[model samples]
Target: MKLLLFEDKLRENFFPLTLTRFTGDLRCGALKLRQRLEALLTDDEVSFLIDSSIEDLYSERHPDWQINLIKPGDKLFVNCLLKYSPTLFDKIQTLDHEQALVQGNALVAYRSNKDHGSFDPDSVLKQFGISTENVDDALYKHPADLVHDNGRMITYDFDNFFSDKDNSFETEPGATILNPYNVWLGEGVELKPGVVIDASDGPVIIDNDALLMHNSVVIGPAYIGKNSIIKVAAKIYENCSIGPVCKVGGELEACIIQAYTNKQHDGFLGHSYLGEWVNLGADTNNSDLKNTYKNVVMHSYNDRPPFDTNTMFMGCIIGDHTKLGINSTINTGCVVGTGSNLWGRDLISGYIPEFSWGEASLLQPYRIDAFLSTAQLVKQRRQLKLSNKERSLYTSIYHRYQENQ
Candidate 1:
């Protein structure tokens, strides 16, 4: 059977995070949503139905995988935002042709026998003579949902994927592990002296080549991704996912820091989602709780007004390639868009538009040439380059912002 993961109409609700990648690529647990789904459907051939904005980039990154090209056959279509579980997988596997599993108005998965050149959930439902089956499975509606669901997802991913695995590396002398059975270390992981891992509440999975320096405390459920570094005396609280090649320090709680980002300094970041290539300079911190302790309100790309998140804790949603200078202060529920540079001691709050430059109150559009140059340099530090395709995409985004202004 062919398995196709597709994004739906609510993609813009994720905003700046989804601006650079697909929703399925978001880190929910120890693994991405797509990764967990692929693991469960290992027997079937996998493909993706992604937005046209990212089609070329996705195709360029994963040359071997099929994107948007549907063939005539019995196929299983799954929503990328659907939260994965063993029970859900079993239910989806039981789907017969022309049947769709839905949760409320959102279609979760369907099995179809008809040939469709492209994927359109409405078209598929109408043309395939689909019969609907109601399901209670949850779907991610906003970026904060990733933060709120992280701990549960971590436990689920660990129980399903790593529970049977033996430690691939030995813990060094003076490195302490509480509830050792709940901790899984991957190959080449270095746990330096004074490093402590506490997993009594939930599991902790440290991926390959990760380094935990002296005096660091990791309280699970948490994930330290491949080649990532936990700086000295860093406090990584429960429900945090630090993605591959990141350098994290200070304190983090219920946060998802995506790949190649750096927070390698003393700061407190809580209940937030950060995209790839983000940098938080020394002592930069964000406020997760308001002075009145009210539910946080955040701006959405599709929603004109800021909407209530229904949660008292929310720090910020920072887009890819954004940078914050030393001692920067981010107010509760702030949203920073892509390719921006923000600095100063003033409190940064409200919705900052894409490619914005300068202090919080004195924002201006960043020169496209200058932003691209800096972006190229940033990638080159990791031995990667900003390709022509990426450059064109960035240019288009900049022009779109300009056109709106």
Candidate 2:
């Protein structure tokens, strides 16, 4: 049995992270969805059938995989792959148009308005006798759904929610543990006396060498990557992923920060994702909700009328090596491409092109030297030496965006 994880229309719902890879690659609940599925299907041969966009990116890195194309009668197993539930396997095994409910899975399946048949690996999923469905009603699972509450502590699969263990655990000066047991503190990690972890419900994991300074409050279902630091008085919340070697603070929720980004100050960021080597200045915030509860509209590369994202809570997507200035307020569903620098006191609008700079009424192209200098500074703060390969990558990004400018 070959397990094929297809990148369905959920790609639009999961941007920034999905921009680089498939949905199964997304990490959450102490494990990635793909990895979890692999564990369950130990006897099967598992692989991915991702979007053409991802195929394009991975092709250059792994030439042999270029043959990994969607073909007719491919016999693929189709899944949204955005969120993982224990019952997902059964659901995929028996999904159809009329009798859609599979066992105990609560996820709703609806009709997909987009024509995914052209792009979807339909034939591949058919091999399992589990053909794909174009359902727009596929209700996304929230992080809270995975949690199970135990009176003493919440035990979730391999991870623990809030437990009495955190209560008995000692904290250094200035470290505050709000909702105990909700967070996992890895070895060599230090929590400055005032660091507050509010794992009132969900679990928070502070990986090895992570430090939370005084006055930092981290809510449940949060992950602070290895060797990262939470600066003083940072207010972080649930469903946020702070990647390794980063420094973060401010208000963040449902945001995934790829390795080595910094948002170290006071700001409100919700429903967003950031790529590697990005930085957010003090008071830089993103809007997750709109005046009306209507679906969020996002600006794409070719589409002029902001694309309908279906979800009302969509936020911004910042690509790799991007930087933003202090007091910057981003509009909902904005997409900031790789290597760009944005700043201003005013609220910024429109899609920011890759490697372009600023969006305060007038947008400008960022100088490579200036961008590199900032990148160097960020690396230094994290006490990391910039590798030649990374510098070369940045150089390539600089040139690639220069063409667009």
Candidate 3:
């Protein structure tokens, strides 16, 4: 069977993050929503139905398969917005062939004999049926929903990544392991002394070449990615996902860091998401909870008004290639766009647009040439060069931003 993962109307709710990647690419746990779905449907052929804005970049970044392609057989179309649940298959099991499984005001999934229809997201769903009534609401509706319920999503996705018949990795001696069976290790994973992994609350999975440095504590429901280093005395609390080749230190809880990022300094990042190629300078702290204990309100470029998250805890969301100077502080629910450079003595908050050069109140639009030079230097530090394709992509996005302004 062919599996089609479709993005619905809620895509706009994911704003700046969705500007560079698809909704399914957002990291809620060890695996992306698309990866989590693929793990469950291992036997079927899978493809993503993403937005046109990211088509060029997405196709270039991932060239393995052609998306939106359907074979001449029954296909299982699934809504990528929903949380990956074991009951998903059970819910659709009762539906007959050619019948679309829907809740109230959304298209859950459907079985079609053939895949011959306009794949446009706006018009495709109408061919089936979609409405918002009072049925079992979709697990996801906005980007904030991903952050609000990420802790639970971590536990669910973790089970699929590490557990597949006696999931076992490796660990060095002299490190404390709280529930060995619940932890999964990848190849060549090294551990230093005075490192404690508490897996009682949930499972801990460390990927290949991940170094658990001296005196660090990583609680369960956490993940350490490949070639990543957890610096000395760092306290990584529960429900966090650190992607590959990252250097994380300080304190973190319920956060997600994409690949090739750096936070190797003394700081507190909680309940947030960091895009790829981010670098957090020393002592850069983000406020996750407010003093008044109210739901976090976030401002964005996707719309005119600042939106309410209705969640009590939320940190700042940093986009890719964004760098923060030493002691830079960010306010709660702030959104920083990609290619932004911030370093100033002030505590910054609010929405910082892409390619912005600033220190809080003072911000200047970063020129494309200057931004590309800095981006190339940052990539070179990791022994990688910025590709021509990436340069073109950035140029396109810059032009689009100018048009919007």
Best of the candidates, lDDT: 1
TM-score of 1: 0.96
TM-score of each: 0.96, 0.70, 0.92
The per-model lDDT (C-alpha) reads: 0.89, 0.61, 0.79
Model 1 segments more than 4 A misplaced: none
Model 2 scores worst on lDDT over the 10 consecutive residues at 145-154
Rank the models by lDDT, top first.
1, 3, 2
lDDT (tens digit, per residue) of candidate 1 on 29-135: 89898998888875778889999998888888889988998888989999989886678878889999888888887888999878787788756655536798788
Superior by TM-score: candidate 1 or candidate 2: 1
Candidate 3's C-alpha runs over 4 A off are 102-106, 128-135, 164-173, 402-405
Query: Residues 61-166, candidate 2, lDDT per residue (tens digit)?
Result: 5565422443333232435453444465456444443233321232232122222344333332333333234343333432111111111111242252323354
Give candidate 1's whole-model lDDT: 0.89
Question: For model 2, what is the C-alpha lDDT against the true structure?
Answer: 0.61
**Stronger candidate by lDDT (2 vs 3):** 3
Clash count list over all predictions? 0, 28, 2
